[model samples]
Target: MIETVVFDVGETITRDDRYWAAWADWLEIPRHTLSALVGAVVARGQDNAEALRLARPGIDVAAEYHAREAAGRGERLDESDLYEDVRPALTELRGMGVRVVIAGNQTTIAGDLLRGLSLPADLIATSGEWGVAKPQPAFFERVLEVAQAAPARTLYVGDHPANDVFPAKAAGLRTAHLRRGPWGHLWADTPEVVASADWQVDSLTQLVEVVEDARRSSGS
Candidate 1:
């Protein structure tokens, strides 16, 4: 049975795509260029530090993007109501006797952002504070260890294929791909990528059903 549901914060639990979109707009660069830069760095088989060096320009863009995101902190949006469902979903999962943990590539700012959005603060288990990042296998391993969760009894949910699903599967955890929304553009048309996920959902609401099915099958 899936005893715990681990989530990626940025795009999975919250609608933070505006950060990326702002980066692309601010850099005056195509979104694909940013993607290529990041992908090339990851493909180089270097450590995260080296990847960061290769991706420095994009990082600068990201800083500017975060500034913009921070500036509009209290403005709020009607469509942002999508995020309101997150806390209740987490509450329901906890009520079902399942543990909830957030595993994301965020810095200390993550705590503030979660608080600003009124998300459950206690659920976060991030790499930024832990000094790691996603798709690194070690990151997920750390989260599992910290959460006292076995790989087989945990599910990693995230919006990115490589960053979320790929490494989680490599670490022996089941993965659910949040297929809709802005991150959809990150996916490539490849058979391997397409077949990587154990389950895929277009919305977080759908996750409730997926978890219930898993629970029933496992007789939890």
Candidate 2:
């Protein structure tokens, strides 16, 4: 049985509407241009680091990312940013004795921001705190450790194919591709990435059904 539901932050769980725009503005690129770059990165099955190089050659990606973070790029998240279905789904999962965790590659400030929202997750972990980020197996490995879950018994839900679905699945967790965020819609049509997800949903309400079906299929 899948005992833990690990969710990607930023766009998957909480809506940090200011984030992408902030990054784009910092890079002196229009938000639409940055969005296009993201789509191209996803279509090519590339990681964010590579996307950074492609976006601007000879650029210090890490330095710029930190600069963006220091500026509070989407650092302020609240209940208002959450989709209507988020809390109910989380509550339902917890009530079923399932653990819900917000696990994602986010800025260091994200931990505090997420915790402040009281989103009903049993744990909230960010890449900054872990000293590693997604698309790397190490990140998910720590997630499993924190959840005290076997990889196969965990379901990772996210909008990014490269950063979330593929990497989490590679680490042996079941994957859910939630289609609404930029990466979700941009890479939605990418054949292989879409095929990698064991489940896909349009909303958090649909996630409950997916979880139930998965439980049945797992015979637990």
Candidate 3:
């Protein structure tokens, strides 16, 4: 049975509209242009941040991010960023006695912002805090350690196939590929994603039922 549900941040528990929009504003470009470039990079399996590099060639994206922070215009998160199903679904899972963790490839600031939201989770963490990011074996290893459970009993849920599904599965946890964000919907029907995901869900509410069904099947 699944004892722990670990979620990804961007495009999983939260929408990424503000993230790309912030970049568009920072680059002084139309949001659509940067959004289109992001889609293009995602289509080609390139890093999503490649859109920023494409917007301003030879620009140091990291340096610009620090500059934005220095300028008091870095990442921002509020309740508006979360999906509608996030609160109720997470609360219900916790109520059901399942451990819920929010772990993703986000920055330290984002982690702080998320904690400020007071989402119903056991722990919230990010790559900036852990010094490891997704698709890396070490990242999933940390997730398993944080879970405090056997990998087989931990479920790692996210929208990205490469970063979420494959690596988490390789790390021995059950994988749930959520079909919500761009990467989620775009690769939802791909054979590899279908094969890699132990559970393919469109929303967090549906994920609750998955865990419930698992419990029944396992007689837990």
> Per-prediction TM-score, please?
0.71, 0.82, 0.99
Write model 3 residue lDDT over 167-201, tens digit each, in one string: 99999999999998899999999999999899999
Tens digits of per-residue lDDT, candidate 2, 50-111, equal: 65576678989778877766776634566777877799989998888889999888877879
lDDT of 1 by residue, 1-220 (tens): 7888888876677665454444555555676665565556545534333433454534653465467667764223234634656777777777777788877887666644555654543467567678888878789879788666789888888877778878999999988887644453446334645687778777666777888999889887
TM-score of 3: 0.99
Q: Report the error of model 1 at residue 137, Å.
A: 1.7
Candidate 2 at residue 144, lDDT?
88
What ranges in model 3 sit over 4 Å off?
Answer: none
Q: Top model by TM-score, which number?
A: 3
For model 3, give the 10-residue run with minimal summed lDDT.
Answer: 47-56
**Clash pairs (backbone) in predicted model 3:** none
Taken over the whole model, the C-alpha lDDT of each candidate is: 0.67, 0.81, 0.95
